[model samples]
Target: MDEFLKWYFSDHPIVAATLGADGYDHTLGDWTADAWHNREREQVRWLERLSAREASTLDDAIDRDLVLSQLRGAIAEAAWPEWRRDPSVYLGTIFTSMYAPFQHRLKPEPELVSAALSRLAEVPGVLAACRANLDPDLAAPLLVKRGLGQARTGRNFLTRTIPSMVEDPDLRARLAEAAEPAARAFDELVTFLETFECGGTWRMGERLYTTLLREREMLGYGAAELHEKGRAAWAELDARMQEVAVQVNGSRDWRAAMEFLMDDHPATLDEMRAEYEAETRRAQAFVREHDLVTFADGEECLVLPSAEYNRPVLSVAHYMAPPPLSSSRQGVFFVPFTPDDFSPDQVRQRLRTNAHAQMPSIAVHEAYPGHHWHLSYIAENPRTVRKVFRTPYFTEGWALYVEKLLQEHGYFDTPATLLAHLDFRMFRAARIIVDTALHCEEMSIEEAESFMSTKSSLSPGTAQGEVNRYCAWPTQAPSYLTGAIEIDRIRESFRGTLKEFHDRIAGSGGLPLGLAEQVALA
Candidate 1:
């Protein structure tokens, strides 16, 4: 058990350092082809060691649950081509490591500079690892958008973000010298990827896809059943949205009515921030006032603009939890502005996603009673396993579940807000259609984005980015609606207050929804 701590401690030293952990204060771990193969081998051994344990099952359920999550991931890491196909995995690692040391000063000044300098120097090696490891044949061509976007972000981050974080003149000078090579590395990556005459047939097919649902998410049904589930959700949400649109003085066609809400958004960027901040506070206050869910005592949230490192992956808003081991515990809720590099129409569309009517619900989802709230409780225990394992089904599901819960409890408070809330429900429902269809080889990138834009009423560029993510991740897109469906079922099955229901699930340590239901009822 103790070995597990040392083994897991800084496996991804930069990730650990980002979360304020030590032992990685001056290094970016190996990013070579051999290192990744080693990672796969280690995953196998860890799973074997975990399965070999001879404890009573009932007594060790929490540890077992955590291991189960890691076990599924280990299987996929061995089976899947992600380290090769997904450029974000490499790009994210490089860019994130460069700034993560500064994000958390886990050590004193001298160490921080040396750490940052060492990581900055290693950026070229990491990018080289990306080139060496990625098999162009397995790469999803649709993700070229992400690759290109990240290349731009790499240049921008070094020019803008890195300097601000590295305050010391000599350290800043070293980072500047290292910046050119990292930027050149990303540029070379972009040029290399563009040469491929490849297609994005990134399907998991029937059997393994179904196995992912059954084993990883603990679902009773398989891929085909979930397809029907998604289709049904899409139909139901659209109908409900049309019905709600009437209250907003919207046209009978819900799409036309949603346009009204889109136009009802904040006029300028500053106006948008004020609205988001105010609504964030409102959502936090409502959770506390209504006693909707338990908030972690003394946990504070800082509303900030999102980082440039992985923009398209994170999109408009994301939450950063306090390091599981940090003394200063505060979570950051990042709300990003549209990049100036985008075309005017792209900016308009991205801004609409941050529309006034939707901001409060987003506030609820990202901050109070959602990610920040859920994680705050999860952070209370010193359980390293929980920190290591997160199933999208539970994490994203809980966030969406709370969005719906708030609407049902009159948190929307107005017809415009009601329309905005439905907009997101339908958006998630649409991801079900797009995610499976793309991976099932039923749709092209164009077709998938069209489905998303039509279903969610988002702009083309915004929809393109959304579908771009689905191309990289097969089953994750469906987690939003699929997980919410299970939560709704569990909510109806159990006889208890909402707070009691959520607290029980929270206590279960973010189990997959099906297993969570079993534990919650038990």
Candidate 2:
């Protein structure tokens, strides 16, 4: 199963990588639609080649129905893609960076691009074949419309998002030059769509659309449930933030407290990077101390400025892919270079982002004990089904939960630093309200932005980018809060049951800590 699962995921690394890119946490149409369709035919062919027995289970029934339900729903949702008015719609970032490697294989000419897209149209037929074989009926117009609405929101992101080095004129100039390649590349893809066909006998409607949500939920948690979890988790974190805020700035609110800390705790970009590297090394030490999992020898961290290809202006910081499982090398924690114009105060705020993305607990979130640890473990997983089926929500949620866990474990001793963690949690929780309200609850983009800025006191520029991520991708933003909440609940339930905190990590080597009860539940 492990061998097979590796082969399976490796077969679609491009699709997986594209999906892994950022969203702030929803599946934006532009980032996914073209590549998604491009691979559908190949996926179908892959499925057809699988022996019926091989297709049926990784070993035994790993909730096979749930998997099929998700796949069918994806087919349905892809039928009538909508175009939104957001800049996130067009440019693929780190998540979709995998798409870049394939670009050199294509011609820039519109005719050639069109022909390629037309060839991709063959996917619908393959989907139809699957439908003929399985005859799934999952009609949910509202769900399909939800997809269309999401696509509409993403349309704006395609054309005019800025470079990540917002304050650097030279890099800024370099980025603009960089855009030439990406713009031309994206235009070629868009041009291809003109003659592209969506074939297959399977109709796109309600049932199929709903199934996608259901499958994703099975992989993670239900959307409505996730929102509730996010809200509840936010409330708890808010209470904690209040405590920390008072400690930092007596009687002041979180906003004033954060500002005070930013002003007082300012660090230069170089100083900030050094601190991040030190913090990350400390995290690695913790992982080793706990004997949590295997580690790469002398695994150096990578921290660099965000590139122009995918990173848009107002971007904070993010991580890149770790070394492949076979490589046995450490992953990178990329810190986008700050511009000279950024105030010391601004740079301080950016430093907090390192903690969010790279701290030991965050390392657990991004590399070991989180994405890398678990992914690497699963890459080496004995169970084929488990290895092949990657759950983004589970993966991301676990990482977010790790950040919170660090604080709970008395990791943040400083009042200001603690405030940063609380703010991060709030930022994620706010995503639930922002994403759901924006896409599903009919909130205008401005209303969503206002909600983020006024409610959180985050800078307007940051707030806009955050809201755009939620807008472009729908259910995803809530996952950090939701996934973290779920993991917390499970841990609380097992507080006395487990002998050691790190022991739990060892016990559930490749599975999510949150799902420990599922086997019993099943």
Candidate 3:
């Protein structure tokens, strides 16, 4: 068994890095079994390819140890944080990313989804046993939220909207029409999920967090002092936002100016969804015209409204995970489709949210040049343990950086429109402060919410909700601020080093979609 395990371990890193999974694939689920099968196939492909890459003798004990070491390292690096927090649920995140795109492709029988989820439920135990043999100091953190962000958004979606939709036959029919096959698969998988469990409770302690922080730093950050840096960064972004607000509203107070933008075009949910779809198309055109980034063949994206049950009561907006690499599914920008009575203004607010969330610049971050792009690029690039080991700061930082780059490059040609972009950037920065202060520093949620409201110009309700999420998952929110800052630094360094070569950053075949085009240059 150990020898068999060693052979398995040797191939696992390639599988993890080349065929990676994100967090949502763990916590929230789609209604399909085929997704699981697709992921399994990815693992198999990774193993077969790895075997072909290294013709080294596999019969020796030394080869076995070497292979096993790499395998254990990959699993430990990715799974330990969760295991330390709770040995039982560590595997939840390991399998999450594979579900959506994989399922979309393989479309396995529904029973397969249920069976696969049940099998995954036992992964924590297997990981715990392996951890017993490994060095705790070198172990990985379980569940990095980057992959899981969508899951959090999805959980919020189901908890809030499913009940109401179920009550309305017509609406429920529409939802099922769009989501049934996925939902049914999800229901089958959920039976295997431990509903009573709290994900954070199973997280690592100070020591583990410190170790993970070190691993994160190795990815180019100077240190793991997220709290102080996050606060200071947020403060700076607020100052930038203030300047934009003044530009947009000459004599108007900045706070009032932001609110006016929010209140300006309040509409029904349907109207908001339509506007979102339109804005994304416009944003894409802007990217093409300015030569910001290139979209790959078959990279079709969607801007749809979020189902009522899944909408966050307090979250102004969120982005869904990009589709898996092997399967060419476009990412979706989901807006909340609330009723007309629920603050008709909320609908209009959603339009701006969608514009920011689904913009081509954002698509670059979340999809093309950001998350999806980075992941796909790394998949085909050099083989390093770190390749499979993503640092959220690097990934998220690049995304945030892209958002600002779009604004600077004249994507926001109008004042009021650009003001909204600044406001959103400020909101992201405030998230850094709110998340850091609430978690590491032990600030109360209310205090954090107040800080967000005043600094980011968010509503009290929305502010509270963002604060809550940061509290539930500490260190995660800091990724945006810290990530953007690092990406900017890298870009500046690259520009200085290769001033004439900067155009090479976006040249064809530089880096695949969704990853940082700049990182490839770096």
Candidate 4:
């Protein structure tokens, strides 16, 4: 198992670096077709070897299953032809490879700076491989446009953000020198994408989509059943939101209540950051006072502004988990306040999307007792497989579950705050519908955007941005609600205190819903 893990990390250095694995900081992944084929062959061999081995204990069996699931998922992904169809795959790889070294403080600044330079030197070669692997005819038009946007973002990061992040004159000079060619490489990619003729569709279709849910995600239901489940969830949540709307204001119109809450947001970015930070602290205190779960020692969650390049796509806020293997278990909760570059209307829309009343739920969801809290415990687990093999179903589901748990515990006693929490839940419920519909060819992208806007009360721009994400990442959108439902089922069956149930499920790491139930119930 350890030998297979070492090879897996080495073979996928970008992923390893993202996961905070050492010895991969100076390397980037090979995106060439030959590399893909080689890795696929290697994965097959490892899968066979692991499968043939008998498990010595329950922990061993679980670890073997986790590794086997990852290998199967990777092999299945390789067969999807995404490398040939999506330029964004390569562009995203470049951004993550460059970003991870700087984001995590696992190594010294000098070593990280040197690693960044090494990766910078490889940027041109990676872009060349991207150009060579992608077939214009097989590319989706939306993804091609997205690739161009990402290329521009990458160039901006290389020429601007990277330099600003470095303070030492000598290191800054060296970075600038290496970054020039990388910026030019991004420019070249932008040009290629601009002229790229694409005829492919973004839909994964029912068969492939179903395979992803069943095989990759290890979900029991297929896409069709999941779509129906989404519809049912949306209806239930919509009804609940309507009831909460009446409690918030003297009316049943949820949109009106949400708009009222939006109007009460902070006037400036500095104030917004302060608000989030305060709310995060409040949530943390509440959890501790309630004894919700065991807090990991030395766990710290910092609420800060999102990086400049990430603001355009990040919408409102996101959580950055600490590296599982790192000595520092400090997570970052990034809030993307409205940028000064946006027009007056755009700025208003952005602020409205992240309203004042929503801060508590958002803080609870992304920070304390949500991603940061859950992931901190996972990081402390003795099993490396638990740390390495995570699924959105577990991670996202746990976060969503906590949001409701807090509400039930009277943490969100205020009608407006509870309404905000329900609004977020309704949005996830809507995501299930849109995600299944889009990939199953039941709805068009335009329709999905409209459905999201109407159901979630999201701005057109925000809805479109979200739909694009769903198109690029199939089967992930449904994980939030699906995982929450599964967790609720597990908790219902668990014969323990609420804190014990929370601790047990979270400490088991982010496993598949089935495996999570097994561990939690055991």
TM-score-best of 1 and 4: 4
Candidate 4 weakest lDDT stretch, 10 residues: 307-316
- Residues 1-522 of candidate 4 have per-residue lDDT tens digits of 788879989888888887888789787778788997898899899989998999888788878887877777777776567888887788777777776567766777788789999999999989999888887667799877777766777777887787667768788888987899999998898888888787988788888778767776778989999988888988888788889898878899998888788888888777888999999999999999999999989999999888765665567688888888776688899987654467878877777788888889999999989999998888999998799889998899989999999999999988899899998998998999999899888899999999988888688878888999899888889999899998998888999899999988899899888778878877
lDDT of each: 0.75, 0.47, 0.46, 0.85
lDDT of 1 by residue, 207-232 (tens): 77778888778889877788888889
Show where candidate 2 strays beyond 4 Å: 1-59, 63-73, 79-213, 219-222, 264-270, 290-300, 323-325, 338-369, 384-388, 492-522
Q: Judged by lDDT against the true structure, how good is candidate 3?
A: 0.46
Q: TM-scores across all candidates?
A: 0.93, 0.63, 0.61, 0.97
lDDT of 3 by residue, 257-289 (tens): 777666654245566557656666776666567
Hey, what RMSD does candidate 3 come out at? 9.8
Each prediction's RMSD to truth: 2.3, 10.2, 9.8, 1.5
Candidate 4 CA-lDDT value: 0.85
RMSD of 4: 1.5
> Please, what are the lDDT tens digits per residue for candidate 2 over residues 217-248?
44343445455666776787778778878887
